[model samples]
Target: MEREIVVIATSNTHKLDEIKEILSDFQFDIKSMSEVGLGGLEIIEDGSTFEENAMIKAKTVMNKTGYASIADDSGLEVDAINKAPGIYSARFAGENATDAQNNEKLLNLIANVPEDLRTGRFICAIAMVFPNGESIITRGTCEGSIGFEPTGNGGFGYDPLFIVPEYNKTFGEIPAEIKNKISHRANALNELKSSLKVYLERI
Candidate 1:
């Protein structure tokens, strides 16, 4: 059987790997937007919500590649900070802030909040667009609290500061195999997987 060609709208290699791993059960020739000769194709994510941002990228890539495209927008939302840095999680410190810098800013912002009130969650929104101009959107979230300080050096982004209450460990401290199953991105992609199977069958 021939593999279906799909495009993932992201230049980030890590995201591509995670998405590919989750969808491994299916026979898909998943390629990053950059891999499909869409390298350096910058699409502005000016949407106020994660879903809107994900759709923008997905639709852009689908229009360009004429193939099914998947895109996701994810961020950390701290309840103590009024869910701030929601869409700006990547550039919380600045346009080119590093992970460490972003973490520092978040810590300082919530430093005064009591432990019980230091709640937060990781949010992920996935958008899939097909050549037929049809689109599907889904959202997933992982509830947790921000740690007092960074821990472990495993995962990236806010992994070190986001603590899973069930395990009492940061994402950076958890194993990749486990994190891949429970992360916000993981949840969203899993939901998308189910939808994709049915959608593909109908079309």
Candidate 2:
């Protein structure tokens, strides 16, 4: 029989949707933070790096539920901005800033920056916390540049303005299937899957 698995520490429905889609082939049933009734744990993500944040979220959730949990911290790092908004990507504009506000602020910051200086990449760090309190960590990245303006309304966050150089298309311009295959989140999740496969094999 397959071991039961539950993803802890995130109420963001979009994150849950993507993770579920990515790991759809697994034998385990995946659930979101809300689905596990973890709406009470207000995880304070004050870490300076993605790994620290991921671990914090995962550990917090694991401590509460005693279930296998996964958490990730992802952000866009801009070359010209000195890798700024690195850990602060979500709250770049302020704690209460909306997606539009954050995007607008990012655009303005790079408004005068030419195409060559607009290089950036999305970084993701995933942390998995086992029921025994053991943990596994992995990371992945997708390089791209900031577009002149937001385009294609397919995704949330900074997806509309992020252009993948190899594909020459904004993330929001790609279909979910295609995006899920090549996104930063997908890359990180791949590492998680590899670890899962190893764990499963050992059992």
Candidate 3:
């Protein structure tokens, strides 16, 4: 029988669905935190960096459930803002602020800045935790710029304003299939797949 693997750290359904889609090629049964009766593990993200936060969640879940687990922490880093929202992208406006509020605040802050100064990148840090308390980390980033206004309605959060240079479309405007193929999460997942291919084969 194959070993059980779970991604039971985030409450965000969007994140969960995205990860599940990415891991579809794998052989093991993949389950979210709710399916594994781990929906109540409140792993507070108090780490100072993305990698630290990802590890915190991954280790907590791995120790709690004794299963191979994965977690990710991602954010938008604005170069001209000196990475103002690098670790606080989710709560940029406030603790409970909605995506619209966060986007409004970001747009207002950079309203006077030039187009070139609006450059930013989405960064994702993925951490994997094993049953033996060992862990591995990988990172991915997608470069882009923040549009003057939100342009599309497909994705949530800052997607509407994130213009991908290569596609000439905001993340929200691109198909989910296309976005998943080139998003920061996809990049990190590819790295994770490469790093864990051998371990998975042995399991």
Candidate 4:
């Protein structure tokens, strides 16, 4: 039997690859918006929260393709900065800002903050919208502190600055194998997998 075509509502290749690797074991042919002929579709993320943004993206894509679509809205929330850069993480520095620029902005904003007070978390909210109007939303968070400077050049965005106290390393320094297990996106995807099992079995 042919696998089900599940669309991932994202244009970022990095995020698409990460999610694809995580969901590879499932019996579905996961695809991106461009691959499914809807590359031009854009949904405004006017939502104030992660869940709302994720749902908006997922539902929009699902409606466009009439297929099950998944979307994620994730960001870093720094306690010292009052959890700012939450939903605006992507554009924290400015519109169309580079990852390095955003990281620089974040570091500058909390430059005076002490090490112990640099606590924060990576938050991910995943939403899935099925063709039948049924949907699922799950959230995951990974706690850590912001490093004074960027570290290894492995992961993207704030990965180089996010220090995992337990590992004594940032996500950028850790191996992909390890990150796939503990990342906020990984955690949320794991939960989605569990619920997806029931849906997959039904089909």
Candidate 5:
């Protein structure tokens, strides 16, 4: 049997890796947008919500490639700051902000806030768009708080400062093997996988 192809509409290497790892057991062959010749494709993410942004990317990719595609919009939301840097997590520092810069900015933003009040969460919304205009969306969130200083160094983006309450460790401190099972992306992908199973069976 030939393996089905599913293009993940993302250029962020970290996100691509996480999605691939979470869906490793699936029968479909997953390819990053760059791998599938959509590297230069730019889709504007002006959606007010994660789901809308995810849909924009997925639909754009599916229309351009004529293949089923999955896209996710994820970010860190801090309750202390009224959920700032939500959709703009990537450009939190600036348009060309580096991961380190973004992390530092986050740390400084909540530096004065008390540890007990530093509540936050990571949210991920995944959208799958098929060629026939059918689509499915799933969302997941990892509730936690922000650390005053960045810790460890494994995951990307704001991982170093985003604390996982259950483990009492920042995502950067958590190993990939363990992070893959509990991260926001993992949760969203798990939901996506369930829908993919039904979609695969139908087709």
Candidate 6:
């Protein structure tokens, strides 16, 4: 059987691997933008929200390649900071900041806050755009709190500091199989799966 080709519009290897694993049940042949020859293209994310940013990326790749493309935008929102670092989560430290820098900035900002009040959540928005100009958007969230400091040695981005209460561990500490089941991206992808089936059928 021939597999349908779906393009994932990002260069982040970690995200690419996670998405591929989450959607592995499907028969689609997933390819990252880098694999599709658009890796050098830079799409500016000036949108005000995660959905908007996701749409921008999806649309850009779909337009450029004239292929079905999927993109996601995610970030951490801390209730203590009034949901700050929402859209700016990637560049929280600066435009060219590293993941470690961003995590450090977050820890310092909430250092004095009590453990009980360190509530936060990870938000993710995903957009899938078909060649025909039709698109589907979905969102997901993982509720948790920020730890006093970073821990563990797995996952990426803010995973080291985002605590999952039920598991009593940060995302960085959670096993990949478990994390893939409960992550914000996983939730969004779960919602996207149904829509994707319908979209593929009509194509």
What TM-score, over all chains together, does every model reach?
A: 0.97, 0.93, 0.94, 0.94, 0.93, 0.94
lDDT of each: 0.93, 0.87, 0.87, 0.93, 0.90, 0.92
Give lDDT: candidate 2, residue 53.
Answer: 99
Q: Using TM-score as the measure, name the better of candidate 3 and candidate 4.
A: 4
Cα lDDT over the full model 4: 0.93
- Judged by TM-score, which candidate is best? 1
Off by more than 4 A, model 1: none
**Model 1 poorest ten-residue lDDT run:** 194-203
Determine which window of 10 residues in candidate 4 has minimal summed lDDT.
194-203
- lDDT at 137, model 4: 92
RMSD of each: 1.0, 1.6, 1.6, 1.5, 1.5, 1.5
Q: Per-residue CA lDDT of candidate 1, range 8-111, in tens?
A: 99888889999999889888899987788999898999999999999999998999888988999999999988998899999999999999999999999998
**Residue range with the least summed lDDT across 10 consecutive positions in model 5:** 13-22
lDDT for 144 (candidate 4): 96
After superposition, the stretches of candidate 2 with alpha carbons farther than 4 Å from their true spots are 1-3
**Which candidate tops lDDT?**
1
Weakest ten-residue segment in model 3 by summed lDDT: 1-10
Question: After aligning candidate 6 to the native by TM-score, how far in Å is the CA of 94 from where it should be?
Answer: 0.5
Candidate 6 Cα misplacement greater than 4 A, ranges: 201-203
What lDDT tens digits, residue by residue, belong to model 5 across residues 1-203?
Answer: 98878899988887888888778888778888888887898899999999999999999998888888999999999998889899999999999999999988888888899999999999999999999999999999999989888899888889999889889999999998898889888899999989888977997
Candidate 1, backbone clash total: 0
- 1-203 per-residue lDDT for model 3 (tens digits): 77467764788887888777777777656678877788877888999999999999998888877787889999999887898788899999999999999999999989998988899999999998989766778898899999999998998889999999998899999998899889998899888888778666766
Candidate 2 vs candidate 6: the lDDT winner is 6
Residue 126 in candidate 2 has what lDDT? 94
Clashes by residue pair, model 5? none
Sorted on lDDT, best first, the list reads 1, 4, 6, 5, 2, 3
